[model samples]
Target: MEAITPFLNANQQISVDIKTLREAPDFKAGEVDIDIRNVTPLFLNQEEINAHYLTTYKFRLYASQAYVEEKGIPQSIHDLDAHTLISFTKDGLFPHTYEPQAIKCKQHLIIDCPLAIANAVENNVGIGPLLPHIARLSQQSLVPILHNQLRQSLNIYYTYPASLTQNRMVQDFYNYLQSLPEDFLKGRTHLLAKRPQKINPLSDF
Candidate 1:
């Protein structure tokens, strides 16, 4: 909702498909119009597609206060091995390098989407990596843990078919996205941050 609400309200007769693409979509076949992915494809053929540097997404470990109280805060990264950890399937740190195996997460869950990961954390399912902005989606506040230790910075790319570079709609939306600040995408500019937070109940039922 955060990324497309404005565009949806401003435009009409447009369809958008948002997902994590493991392989390049057949843009020419109209399989997809635009793709915003955190990891740049290792074999992005510059000759066929255009990849523009988007923004860097910083992910930190987050766990609901309830989860912390139940499982206890992981004092060290290794401590995560003893607790439930949620993460994307591959858990790639960067575009150039992907995780060779499911080693990052030592426990039950391999969510394929970041939004789902946030939901899992909000429900006190497990500690997982999430962008700061997505943290606000939770009804209850989620605390950042090992902020200094468990942090991931991945660069996102704005990709489209080289042939459609001149298309008005594509250019218009891309320009609008670039006009927004990096903080806006990362949750630094959210209303929840500015508003006074409601007090959490003192007792956990």
Candidate 2:
């Protein structure tokens, strides 16, 4: 959203209302200009909505240092059952397909917010899946668990009215999104891994 702020400021005519897509609001009302979602909308065939492919994000299971010390790292999927698990309350957005049912059944704590889940894991509440970008940003050092085996990915999409495809502001925002560099999202993950400093746990909130 910050990437296109300058354009929005200059245009003055274009405004954006960001909302979670899970609530199933009326996008056809003509008031909502763009709807960005982490998952694909179920009503894509509604004829009024046009979805645009944004980008794909990679995710991995992460555990706090304290949790790892206590439970030890999970060597395999079967071993995960022995450890406490942290997960999102919404099953649809769990992000892992390898062992979706198994993981869901083993959740020790169900959290609605992603940041809260990360914080809980940092505080040694449990192990959970997180995007590399989010893991790097957290104040706690999250060790990647089952990194080689439990990798997962999700695609992000933005939807708008087909009729608004020709709108200059909409086109400009879309173009700005496409202009982002390939490594732009992963740069922090790589940099953080090499740093020796520890992050303050309080800053995570």
Candidate 3:
């Protein structure tokens, strides 16, 4: 949402309501007025939307140097089974599961939040596939794994209601989101494996 904040701020012509669907008591298809739905690729039912598409999200995996050195890097599609899998099961299916028979299921663990999975992998609990954006933030502590077999991307959508007001602001916001820097969506882990300096703290007088 940060990526498109500028667009919303630029336009003052429309009133906006933000609601967390998870918190809504009567938030059913029949109750709420359907205006527009900006859906993420993570949606289990992309076919349900069948509307406008804005952009895509790429998913990647990260692992520890020890795991790679010991097991050897996975070189082909079937190699995912060789590593421990971490995932946030709130969405029901793994990101890569979108494709038919993409990876062989081996060891798997489900956490409640995105941060939880990221934190676990960062601490070298196991290798995990996550949004590149999240991976980038953790790169200083974690390493990316299985470069060849981990390639996949998902599309984000911006569905509009029949009566969506023709405001330049909404359109601009979508454009800004689409125009976000590539790095904002990707995590660079190769650099993390290199030598990193340790910081020491002492009591201040």
Candidate 4:
């Protein structure tokens, strides 16, 4: 936040309104020039914006290196069906979708929060997903489970208010956010400009 302050406050004519990525879809829902575009990942389809590509996370299964080395790595998503999955009840963090055949784990452990999920995974209660930051913090207590395929990162965006076009401060702030260090929007992985190798979110863009 401090790094971008200089840019946002450079002009005092207008104040920029910062909003979440989910709020961007409705930027121009009923207005004009309030277009919402996907600015990250430099996808092919500029029309459909995905906040996911702008973020990154580590994909891990709760298991010791010794155990995995002996059992072999999970080769497919379906392989997870045989393993217990610990997840947080918090909203918007875990991936959610309507799947008629979604498997119900043999033991669905309910944790109080995200930290609890990581704790459970560290104890080898079950394999689970976690952000890279949290994973790094908990590494000494847990094991990293590798997968045959890498997981897709999360996406985030900043929406510009339609009515603030004439405001220099607001527009400058928007441009500054657009120019934010890619790692700031996304998670730390490769260099900010280095695009992901496998999970190319821009295939639709």
The candidate scoring highest on lDDT is 1
lDDT of candidate model 2 versus the reference:
0.60
Worst 10-residue lDDT window, candidate 1: 196-205
Better of 1 and 3 by lDDT: 1
Candidate 4: list runs displaced more than 4 Å.
1-82, 88-93, 96-101, 110-116, 137-142, 174-183, 186-205
The sequence of per-residue lDDT tens digits that candidate 1 reaches over residues 1-205 is 5755696568645544444446655666655656665534553656777777768887777999999998898777677777887766555421223544334545667776567778888999988788787786668889888888767777766676777667666667667778886666552111110112211100000
Each prediction's TM-score against the native? Answer: 0.73, 0.75, 0.58, 0.46
**lDDT pick, better of 3 and 4:** 3
Query: lDDT scores for all predictions?
Result: 0.63, 0.60, 0.47, 0.42
Which of candidates 2 and 4 is the stronger one according to TM-score?
2
Clashes by residue pair, model 4: 44-205, 45-205, 51-155, 51-156, 52-154, 52-155, 54-186, 62-127
TM for candidate 4 is: 0.46
lDDT of 1: 0.63
Candidate 1 regions exceeding 4 Å error are 8-22, 90-97, 100-106, 181-205
Task: For residues 1-205, write the lDDT of model 3, one tens digit per residue.
Answer: 4543464466434434433332211212322222222234444254432245645666677766666666666666477576666764533324424334345557777774556777877766676766767876765445666665555566544443223235333344446645877554332110000112211100000
Cα distance off (Å), candidate 1, residue 37: 1.3
Q: Which pairs clash (backbone N, Cα, C closer than 3 Å) in model 1?
A: none
For model 4, how does the per-residue alpha-carbon lDDT over 71-166 read when each residue is reduced to its tens digit? 455566556556666654332224321123244555556553456677776766676666655666666555555443434343433333435445
